[model samples]
Target: MALLDFLRQKEFAEISALKNKLALLEKDIEIFREREDRLNHDILSLRNERDKLLKYKDVSDVDNEKERIIKELKDAKEELQKEELESKDNIEKLKKEAEELLEEIENKKKQVVELDNTILLQDYGMYSPVYDFADSEMYKDRLDAIRTEQKNMILYKTAATCSTNWTLNGSEAQGRVMTNQNIKQILRCFNDECDMLISKVKFNNATAFIEKIRKSYDALNKMNSKNAVSISYEYLELKVQELQLAYEYAQKKQEEKEEQRRIREQMREEARLQKEIEEARKDIEKEQKHYMNALLKLDKQLGECDEVEKEVLLEKKSEIERHLSDLDIAIKDIDYREANKRAGYVYIISNIGSFGENVYKIGMTRRLDPMERVDELGDASVPFKFDVHAMIFSDDAPTLETALHHAFENKKVNMINGRREFFNVTLEEIEEVVKANYDKTVEFVQIPQAEQYRESQKILKSLEIS
Candidate 1:
């Protein structure tokens, strides 16, 4: 009887300790969950920043600095792998430790149940042992832990999942956010001082617990929350490289756009100045035409006038002098007006594929954003505004424009090559045309897998080497 009573007291203490540890574990799970949420948000933001940056840079240009980028990528990869291995290994260790503790707790619970059945018996008899069993709340605690165990396990699995996803994205910001959640769980799991983790531990624990309850009992019966953790880690690692590369490209593109904008402003100023010069030239031509007309009139009057006295002739000379003075003033006025009235300036993309310069683009489009459309088609980058400027050269502008169009027709518009002729332009002309007409660069989408395979087969057939 004494032995049974002593065992009950001892069991009570064990149960209390388990409860405390369980609380801590629950807290730890919550920390991880919060961290996971933070990581997800960070990952998405970084992805956006990365995507926006990509719209401006060329893959070919960035490839020149591949060596430097590769090194950075290598370092990031190693760090991520190290963290994943450590966190995962520790989780497994804790799980093993928990299993051993669970066995001990279960043994104690069985003893308490046996003691409960005897509490109704006589004093100093089986009845007294029954009272002891009922008194110790170990049985209640064991049931609670059992119910909660599944939940706790689930929470840990969830934390692992969230943590791994952030890690895989390879963004420092994302990883940091997750780490904040992880710190609390780490403390609970191994106990640490991550501020974010500390705050989230409880919330994570409850969430994980509830999720477990929602799962199928049969599925839960097969114990492997660690498997879920392991899977999450593997998936994250696979995606990290891709995400980082996307970010790098995006950053490069934004810088390119700023440069393009600066060039555009410069072009606008040049066009304005050219417009002024053209207007002045036109005014000079007009004045020259009027002066010639006045000179012809003076000659006609001199030839027709009859011979008269010297005084009369001198007066006529004075009259002609006055008219000459008036004409000079008219010319001056015309020059002044010409100086202020500016002509419209035109810029055209040029030097496309000519041998000694003076080459220009040749393409036709009804839309104003002809060059912009080329960019969407992923054709070529328009280098300068002058390069892409529109012009109407003749009374038959559309017919003469065929020279330009014939220069740039791709002959292939869609991904597949159908017998349908796309255009009648040379390759060189197309490159020039797009450069002269558009500000954005082109980037073609990847061909679908089935099409690629078919293309490969056709190539082999042509070579007779497949």
Candidate 2:
């Protein structure tokens, strides 16, 4: 029995130990379960907060909201990309427009520059024509013609260069409207220059007239202006050529006129010489007839008269015979014919008050009475009446005149033309030359009978005193 009780006590101790271990395990289990419940609650709260923050009222709405938000973000990004592309295109368009505008501005500038250069070239080409001439009475008509032509040319050129239309009615019009202002200014300058040139063209002959025109035109050609005529070089050259041709024509016309005048003067001189020769021949024939008749009458008177009267008649007959011999010689020497004529008388005369001492006119006369020629010479042509120096008859009057002219050729007032008969010689010197040439005595009057001239001089002196 003792052995059985010891074994049971050991068993009871083992069972109590087992029950205490179980109780401890049960308490630990409760603690673990409480912790698990807290962890679960915290996790639910976090999930709810996440859904609300995502703009969803419930868990089912969370996924749809997320999808909508993501889609919205994607659409916004695409729209931003589209806007960026459009901005880039706009930038490119603006850049292109700016380049085009700049090119247009450059082209306009080039056109303006070109236009200015053209205007400058036009302004550089304005000019005028020239003329020249000489001064002389022979060119009087030619000078007048040239002056008229110059004026006409200037008017024409002015019109051409300025494009101004003029009429006799004092009306004006523009020819070309494009350059009207420039043309008007050019016309004003041209007219002013032409007026000045015309005023200065006071010439009496062709040469002087042409010279003045040439000088004036040269001055005009050198003139400059900001707005000048736009005449081409070819046109200007043609105008100058025309002007030269006109000048040449004027000169040729003047030369022809002078030649005609010279020919007329020569014809007149020849006619005068022939007429004088014929008259001289007739006078010689008349004198020969009268002397022969006187000789025959004197011979008959000598035979009928008494001794004293016969002697006087014989002397008269002898004188008549000598005159007849002289007449015969004169007639033969004259050898007058229709083809071969005789020369007349060579006369010397002077007007002392009008022409100083030693001044005499030696000339020929073909009149029947030589004194008639001297009287004719003393007419209204001279200031004073001429004094008769010598009236010398000669069969060869031209030869005698030539001899006298040669003797006083050195003393001639006009040396160029020997026809001018005035000579610086004394009356005594002329008488000696006449006596040496002719056998007959020549009567010379030393004093001038200036009746009209002296009276005029006296009147003039009284007027001066008054």
Candidate 3:
């Protein structure tokens, strides 16, 4: 029984220890459950907070809320990406527009520059004549008539001078007097400006002067706006006409003087040619008589002489006959020249020192000796003697010259004046034109001698070396 009590006590001790371990485990499980409950509450509170932050409406549908939030975020991201692409496109478009605008501005700047440099009117020097008067005297008469009419208009208080009638001290007479004085002063100012511009007007600056006068009219009217005093448009037109007529009149006078000088030169040249032809005829006649007398003497000597002397006399007779034939031909040529006024030598010549290479003066002269005319041409007027390219005898020299001039009309050195017969053309070109127009085969001196010019150049070179 003692042994059974010991075993039972041991058993009771083991059961009591096991019961304590169970109580400790129960307390730990209770603490764990409380922790799990607190954790679950925290998770719920966090989920609620997350829903509020995400603006999720259904708290009970947590998974649906999460899915909806995720989908919304993806949609927002896609929208942001699309907007980013659009923004990039817009930036490129704006860049292109800005570049185009800058190019247009540059083009406008270039246009302004070009306009500033360009001439407003292309017909600068070739001004059209305003008056069709026969002479400068007629132009002067017209100008006098215009001036007299203008003066009469002003004196009679016509439309030439205008003004508004204003009351001065309530007297009509006083108002009239003031208006007259104002009109006079305005007329004087405008006339002075117009006269100044007209005086300065020329072929090149006519356009500028016209603009200035119109501007002056506008400015004077603006300045006298209160008085309403201004020059009439009819008077303005008359003034413009006067300016043009005056310039053209002066030009006409100059042209008339040149024409008169040319006429005098032509008369002198004609007189000289007559004298030369008469002298040449007389010389030929005298030479023919001398040759005839020599032939008669040789014929007498041939009748009396022996074989050797007879042969010499016959030879001398033949030479004398030949001489007489040449003299007769020269007399006939002189007679023809004197009879035919249009018969002359058309010469092509060049002065390389005066003009340049390929420049030729094609002219006609009725001189008995055409070389004399060429020599006269190469006289003191030119720096060097002219080299003759061709000297052609034409029945109607003027017509042939006119034909050549018409052929090379655009190749003239002085295009404005048809009288200046110098042409800038190649020898081949001139030959071609001459062959085409003239029936006769012409020989052209393709190479110029230019002897004096070449010598002068050599001298200059030597001087420079020294």
User: Which candidate has the top score in lDDT?
Assistant: 3
Cα lDDT of model 2 by residue, 403-423, tens digit: 888988899987645567899
Better of 2 and 3 by TM-score: 3
**Superposed model 3: Cα runs more than 4 Å off:** 1-126, 169-171, 299-311, 462-466
- List where candidate 1 sits over 4 angstroms from the true fold: 1-286, 289-360, 363-466
* Cα deviation of 111, candidate 3, in Å: 20
Q: Model 3 misses residue 89 by how many Å?
A: 36
- Candidate 3 C-alpha lDDT tens digits along 170-284: 9988988888888888788888877876775666656555655676677677788788777788777777777887787877888898788878977887898899987877888
Ranking by TM-score: 3, 2, 1
Query: Candidate 1: lDDT over CA atoms?
Result: 0.42
| RMSD list, candidates in order | 36.4, 45.4, 30.8
Q: Which candidate wins on TM-score? A: 3
Instruction: Report the CA-based lDDT of candidate 2 relative to the real structure.
Output: 0.58
